[model samples]
Target: MTNVTPRSDIVLDVQDAVKHYALRRRGLRAPRRSVHAVDGVSIRLHSGQTLGIVGESGCGKSTFGRLITGLETPTSGTIRVGAHGVPIAAAHGTGTVQAVFQDPASALDPRMTVRESIAEALGKVAGRERERRVDEALAAVGLTPEFGVRYPHELSGGQQQRVCIARAIVDRPDLILLDEAVSSLDASLQAQILHLLERLQQDTGTAYVFISHDLRAVRQVSHSVAVMYLGQVVEQAPAEAFDRGLLHPYAVALRSTEPRILDEGTEHVERIVLTGEPPSAVSPPAGCRFAPRCPIAEDHCRSVAPDLVEATSGHLVRCHKPGELTLSGVARADAEV
Candidate 1:
């Protein structure tokens, strides 16, 4: 059986995080609208482990990443990292964590050479030591030292991403938030980056919060997986549980689109395709955000908001009928607690 033990050494804890953005008209009779970017999202990442977050575009994946890294503060709830056991609130001005954005080109300074870009992040270290750290970080991401002097424009998309990854690691942060870190890279390059990430985690033991829209990439790197819809976490479980069967409707639908991991001689399961656009986060539909699109959505889903309950060991989901929906040979492995 897969290791389902919740690692005792959790590096980051996000407890009921809620973030909302208020929209206001320019002047006069303007009513304010609040965009509910992250609504009651909770996650836990262990030291030296990768937690993959997956969702469609505008599903608050990026926003949740920002909240964890303290780039954007949560309107409610708290985020704590490595200090104690409690879920402490993440506040501004803390550099204990780092981030790598989606756009490799935009992330790097056009004028600064790769070495300089990485050095800037390690500015605290002076003289020859800082330069050596830059070299080490670049090498960690499989980039040659000679590539350091080149500007962002001179590097290929993959190379630029390597530089970005190097920049994030130069500081040797306890946690790194990678938002679509490898999405822009080619498939082969993406594999290289993913491999590098695994090695880096083993070497430095840094916790990772990896956010992506691709299930395949998430499956490759994550020890745990979280599925988001609208602004809430619909399903989260150990990677092994996801491999067995996803409990939430949204996760099952998303997984149906993922490439099958079977090596050979396995029956191919049909995909569970979902229809319709997600409801507005500002005024999300009653009950579940997925009800409007869920193939098995019922009256309970349309009327009452389902609480996030544990349906199995190391797995939590928000749905009225947690494991009632099945696909192919998949079955619910646990009951709601």
Candidate 2:
């Protein structure tokens, strides 16, 4: 793992951001309800750092990514790229942020060649300059200039993904939102992409917001990690702390379930198996959202929502019994890269 100093300059900052969607009414008399996709989430990222966000499907990971990339507006709160506040409905050409989606084919134009697709993202640069940048981008991702003439359909899955990455970085945006950028690829390809992303960040000093369900991949690429549940961040800490132990029960439960962690053994800390499905975001519980499924829930946890409190330096957890609980983590043996 790389050692990162917390910097004062923030490439991305999100404060109390919320994105809610109202469901269609079943009848005129029926009361309208809204799904709380992202509820009061706040995060910050420094230049050249990657913040990994991990959660189950429908937990609003994608929505948050869209919010940061300016694809979707927040219902409330603020999002900033560098020192400037990002306006709702802002287009992608602002040169502050870019996004790489899970599906490379969907992100690319079927009719456009790789060179054209990359040049389009360059946004107004044309002629020799555009061609130069396109070739440079392709080379940055380990692709030859010859591949630029090929269409998306002609390339393999990994090569197409490399093209998508080249398109994203060609703009040289300050921040990049990677929404499951490696989820579609095989294990070997995923490793290659992750390494490429890390190298790009080191070379360009660009920050990244990586959203994925793969915990191991998250650990490998991120400088810090945030665990979200029911549209809220439950725990956040430096990447090293994830293996040392996480304070939030939900975070601990997640780590305990990892096959690698269990195989290496967690005899010192208890394994908590949660029951029941997560409550709907449209009708989430009044208190801590994970309380219904938490193993250490108490009376207060059921009635009052817990604010994120720093249990230790730079480690935040939204749990009523923050430091009182000792949870299993990925054993040191399994944590070896």
Identify the leading candidate in terms of TM-score. 2
Task: List, residue by residue over 2-106, the lDDT tens digit for candidate 2.
Answer: 235434568788999999999999899999999999999999888889999999888899999999988888999988774344443453456678889999988
- In candidate 1, stretches whose alpha carbon ends up further than 4 angstroms from where it belongs are 1-8, 25-31, 84-94, 259-268, 331-337
Candidate closest to the true structure, highest lDDT: 2
Sliding window of 10 residues with minimal summed lDDT for model 1: 85-94
Model 2: how large is the Cα RMSD against the reference? Answer: 4.8
lDDT of each: 0.85, 0.86
lDDT of 1: 0.85
- In model 2, the Cα lDDT at residue 14 comes to 90
The TM-score measured for candidate 2 stands at 0.91
